[model samples]
Target: MLNAGGTPNISGFLVDAFGKHLVALPGSQRALPGGTAAQPAQVKFAPEGDELLVTEKGTQLIDTFSVGFTGYASPPTPHASSGVTPFGFSITTRGYAIVSEAGSGSVSSYDVEDGKHLNSISAATPLGQSAPCWLVTTGDGSFAYTANAGSGTISSLRIAADGTLSLLSATAGRLSAPLDMALSSRSKFLYVREGNGAVSGFRVMPDGTLEPLGSVTGVPPGAQGIAAR
Candidate 1:
């Protein structure tokens, strides 16, 4: 947990479940680059190590932190923004934490700099389906896929060298109320969960499209949450 309850409208907390005690972790915050002072809506740990990346104020920007037993160290630096609502994040094997902004349906890439944000990946058009809620990237950082809950479909995109984006097609496909997504280590399989209590698995294709593998029932009872394997 991070940045919970740090705002007047919210309570952000970083709690660790060590042994049996749910110890509360210290809370840290900054004014924000967007100047809106919006609350941090989401957070993720780096795939390579303990580095932490967080989205502030509806995915307007990103921040990093180092972890220690007593507490976490200061963040590396404030990364820039893609002007998208970063609702979720995923780390690639190449050492980039791919962040998803559900509001604008885009993804932003960052390289660690002096424990701060130093550089950003330049993307072309926005990534994935419109208004994606979360995403998963490939092992080599060649591709990124997302679950666009707003359009009730999934979208695929190719990651550019500069970190910009290009959609594989103008449209992805019809899906359930997708919330979160998960990709397999081999990148051969993908998963998406719906707010309406449906789970699905898909097989990957050469052109970055999906073929349904299987699905399940008993998802959520409301239009609130989703998950993927």
Candidate 2:
């Protein structure tokens, strides 16, 4: 997310067919809101690919918009995030939005109707951890994980069929200032980016538990985000 002339904007990019070229599409930028304190911490497209959900920290809200065929966006529809300082989130196949609330150290879910309207399905459900800022969910949409930066821990939760969440483990794994996370293509492995110059790996168990796979050190310090393939 970029602050475009004091407004939060989502930029568009184009990649060449050969995957050797990339370019910014300036005209495709969609401005979320202007004249407000909106720090978009994370953005994810709905499973249908016709909508986008952005967690705004500064405004403590989640903004959703309908995406047009040409990549333009409809006016943003703001919704209470059901918690404070909403950060990373994932939209499930059933149109459920699961979000991590850093300020409240909890996770919440909502029903995103037709990519715009939002209704809370679950209030903030605490995991007894601190600063659970970044989140990732299973491909099956049955579980979710959050990296607790302040507590140096990872927490797991079972995402119910109705978009509710239940804490599975408060300390599923440990890291040093975990900031961002990604899951493997099969959602079998989970990786975390640590502020302490390392990325830790964990195996995803059948019951939503995490088994430590150790850490890869020597990553540049202050690395903020990560992706796994």
Candidate 3:
């Protein structure tokens, strides 16, 4: 878990799924860039599972770390992001990194080598939306979607085999303040969490389009995360 209270440090814990318990390991807290304002938005494990990547919005950097056996992370090596306000991101099936830039309302792709070195694969590709705060990629990594909060829309993009990106639809779907997003385990359904305390579902079409599956309301206010299985 991240202690994201305007601090640059992150804490790691051990989880016991069957017991629904969390154990904070000593010496698991590690500092990132911008000591007091890293504003790290998201953390993802590399495809190899031995490295970690964090988006530092405050510093416009992507921090990479080597994970130790005890779940502790090494001192991070920071790389400048391809765009501004890097927020949500994911690793592609080909081990490339796709990131969403909230400030620019665009997305960028990177070649992550050894889970630590990041080489820009493609420059920022504008989705022509606003505040794309969350991103999700299809299971095959051929398609990706971003929830544009400011524009109340979802944008789609195509990911090439070499990690290059191209805009698909800047307004794939329109909703109210879409924030976080998740894909079903089978990658057949997409779920978007709205700022209005509601969760909406969509059927991912064969051509990388979205078909509304309606929504469910009554979620607690301020909820910001969703998972699908």
Q: Can you give the TM-score per candidate against the true fold?
A: 0.75, 0.92, 0.94
Scanning candidate 1 in windows of ten residues, the lowest lDDT window is: 3-12
Worst 10 residues of 3 by lDDT: 1-10
- Alpha-carbon error at 75 in model 2, in Å? 1.2
Cα miss at 32, model 2 (Å)? 2.2
- Position 190, candidate 3: lDDT: 97
Spell out the clash pairs found in candidate 2: none
**Alpha-carbon RMSD, each predicted model:** 4.1, 2.0, 1.7
Q: Is candidate 1 or candidate 3 better by TM-score?
A: 3
Model 3 TM? 0.94
Cα lDDT tens digits for candidate 3, 1-229: 5567756677788888799799888888888876777888998887677778889888899988888777888888899988899999999868888999999888999988765689998888999998998999999999999999999999999999999999989999989889899999889999999999999999999889999989999989877699998
Q: What's model 2's TM-score? A: 0.92
The numbered model that scores best in TM-score is: 3
Give the winner by lDDT.
Answer: 3
